[model samples]
Target: MILAVDVGGTNIRTALIASHGGTVQELRSRVSLGDRGVSENDLIEKLSALFSEIISSHNDISAIGIGFPGFFSAGSGILLSSPNLPQLHNVDLAGRLSEAVSLPVSMQNDALCAAIGEHRFGAGKGHANLLHITLGTGIGGGLILNGVPYTGESGMAMEFGHLRVAGSDLPRSCGCGGSGCVEAYASATAVSAQYFERSGIQTDAGDIYERACKGDKHAKEIIESAGHCLGMAIAQAIKLLDIHTVTISGGFAGAWPLLHPAIIKSLDTELIPPLKGKTTVLRSTLDDTAGLLGAAALIN
Candidate 1:
């Protein structure tokens, strides 16, 4: 059994997993992660308490793995920079968790973890190459190439949200300080903002979708624009990697009904023949457990 923990910006979920021919056990529990006002120490304490409780029941866990949100040094487990959880900077999360739980600890970015989970048991199953994109509080991505998670020079391989897109203002900055990155237009926050800006509607993506379903032209336009932007970014990725199975996860996947058509349309328009219908975009099959399950796979 492996102890899997997914520490998000505002939530912490834990699961006890037993690998059986690549499928995992599903004893799971979750709790609220602190808001911006929460201190680093508070976050650590909350996680430690949860791990301790779980260890009491699942004492035979072979290892502990965590899916952490932020720019982390894979080798050192040091959180260098995290847009959602700035208080985590310089934190030795793996070291702390290992010490607290008395177990070997492993960690990966949430997107990377989610990708591993999808590749192992979700939508990307049986695919040698896979891409996982999380369009949540911010955009994050992961790539599994040849059945391995390919963290680049510094263990940050698929930071796809940071990639610049066409038809965007160069000076437009993303939450990561980059110019016109995918996150600038593809994230849930971006979608809501666009909806509000385009229509006088002060609503979230859900409301926008509802209105669009009712034939609101402005809502439809906003959805299409976001889909186009997301599609263009994915098209560029395809040009470089030629990955066939791409999975979309997180809050933004809610826009799939509106976004996917545009994404497929844009990709088909850009790709050459023979590769036109090759790539298939999928919605994540895993529910909230995806991240934690993927974290557990680090030890599997």
Candidate 2:
């Protein structure tokens, strides 16, 4: 068995999987990193405690795989930058964990790991070219070309959310110090922020979705706008890569009903005649475990 860990801003999810493919067990632990004083050592200790618990329960585990968000040296497993987990910047996560656990550890960008898992076992299975877009706190993505995950030189090519696709009317600033990026409009954070900006009500994306489901026009419009921005970005990606298979995942994607129409409409409007209607966009089939399973794929 292999242990797979997906580190997120809000929670850390871990799982045990058969080396071949498939989850055998899973667990979720809320992360407490919002405190300003939290340090890298604190994060490391929390993760170490979780790993120890997993190792104790599963003695047959042979390797460890981690799906970490943000900028990282994939070859060295050294996190270079983490906007969400700022305390972990420059931390050698895989090296430290391997030393503490006495096991081989491999790591990759969380979005890339999700792409691998989706391509191998979920929505993108059997496709030669795939794009996995994650719509969470921020929009992120991974590219699979010719059935292989493609990370550019030094492993930082697929920062799709930072792609500038927003117009002046919706030019919200991003954490990356950019304005008018896709993430500024399409992320869950953006969804809520947009709603609050217009309606003067502050709530999470899920609540906005729930309100939209109950026939709230304002809430529905905000979600559609987000979809339109996301569609614009995806259309650009399709035009550039010529990849037809795209999978959308993340907690916010649960509102697919509201987002799908705008995405498809924008795609139809933007794609060229030969490419129009050729792309196949799908919601992820792996639920929320794609990251975990994808991480496991790295070591397997």
Candidate 3:
């Protein structure tokens, strides 16, 4: 049994996982942190407390795997930066947690972990090369090349969201300080911001999606714009890597009905003839549990 934790900007999800033939049995999902903002110390304490609770009830845990959203040193488990969770920069989070929990900890970028989970047990199963994208408050990506997870020299490869794309007239900037990045227009935050700006309604991406589902033309337009931008970015990635399988997942991807048409349309419009009909863009089957399963896969 493995303890898997997925730490995101909005929540920290932890679960115990048992894998059996490409299927993962999740014991239960516990949210240690909700939408509340917390300091580094507070976050660490929450993690430690959560682990202690799990340990008190279970035994024979092999290792702890953490799927953290940020740039970190793969060797040292030192988080360098997290645009969303800025308070965690330069913190040796794994080291701290290991001392507290008395368990060896392995940390990985959240998106990369998602990709690994998908490749081993979810949407990208049976595919040797594919891209896994998480679309939420921000956009994140991970790549599998020749049946291996491909994190570059510094463990910072497959940063697809930060890649420049055609800029939108809407005033927006990415967390990475770029204006033309795909995330600037395609992320959940971006979509909600665009909607708020246009409609003067303050709501989250999910609410906007609900409005779209009710046939709100303005909401649909906002979502379609985001989808078109995201699809264009995917086209560039396919052209560059020549990888056909792409999996889209995350909290915001639940709006697939609103995004799929525009994405397919843009892909058809942008991809070259040779790439046409060869690519497959899939929705994640693992859902939110992908990160936890992925974190457990790291230990194995």
Candidate 4:
């Protein structure tokens, strides 16, 4: 048995999964992150409580898995550049959590973990070439080539969201400091910002989709633009990597119906002949449970 955890800036989800690869069972858990009104100790406490409960109920668990939302140095099990999680940078999250629970633990970048999960157990189950693009607060991704997760030399390649758009009004001011990157236009945050800028209505990603369904023109426009931006990136990715499958996950993907056409149109214009209609883009089969389940894969 393995305990897979998806720890994010706002929420943390944990689940128990079979060690060998089968159906993953989600465990009930949640923790508010950051230091605004919460302390790191409180965060630790929540984890400790959950761990204790799990162990008490199922002492057969042998290890723990963590899908961390940040740059991870697997050699050290420490978090790096965890922008969303201000309290986690340079912290030995895996070590601390392992000590608290008395279990062996491993961690990976959440996006990379998702890619592995998709390739090994989800949509790209039988594919050797796979890419998992997460379209939530930011457009992040993980790549798999020849059935292996490929993180560049320094463990941070395929930062797909950072790819720049040739000519655009928007410039990326992401933590990485790039310009007109795909994330600035395709991300859920970006869509909401566009909507807010146009209609002066601040809304979450879900609300953006909801409003669009109700015929809010501004909301509809923002999401469509985001889709186009994503499609352009997808087209480029296909041209360069020739991956067989691309899975869109995260919040914005939920708004896919509003964004799919634009993405298809954008990809149609730039695609190469051999890859024109070869790549398969689809939604994630795993739900909120994907990250947690993916995290669990590290232990295997």
| lDDT preference between candidates 2 and 4, better one | 2
> For model 3, how does the per-residue alpha-carbon lDDT over 1-300 read when each residue is reduced to its tens digit?
788888887667777786342445555544646434568888789889888888888897767888987777755678787766766678888889999999888888999999988888899999999899999888999998999888777778889988877645654677787678889888989888889889999899999999999998878999998899888999999899998899998888989997988899999988999998788989999988778888888785
Clashing pairs in 4: 172-180
> What ranges in model 1 sit over 4 Å off?
21-30, 35-42, 57-60, 87-91, 169-172, 272-275
Which scores better on lDDT, 1 or 3? 3
Tell me the spans in candidate 4 whose CA falls farther than 4 Å from its real position.
36-50, 74-80, 85-96, 170-172
Cα lDDT tens digits, model 2, 1-300, are 999988877677788888888754885554443454567777667777778888888899899998987666756788776767666677788888888888898888999999998998899999999999988998889999998788887678688998888456747888889799989888999999988988899999999999999998889998998888888899899889999899999989988998999899988987889999999889999968888889999984
Candidate 3 has a TM-score of: 0.89
Highest TM-score: which candidate?
Answer: 2
TM-score on alpha carbons, each prediction: 0.88, 0.92, 0.89, 0.87
Where does candidate 2 clash, by residue pair? none
lDDT of 1 by residue, 1-300 (tens): 888888887677777787532455555645787687667778678778888888888768878888887767855666676767766677887888788878888888888999888888888889999988887868888899999888787666788988777875443567776678878877778777877777766787777777888999988887887778778888889989988989998876877888899889988887778678889999998855678778888884
Instruction: Report lDDT (Cα) of residue 165, candidate 1.
Output: 76
lDDT of 4 by residue, 243-288 (tens): 7688878877899788877887887777877678777788888745
State residue 179's C-alpha deviation in candidate 3, in Å: 0.7
Worst 10 residues of 3 by lDDT: 19-28
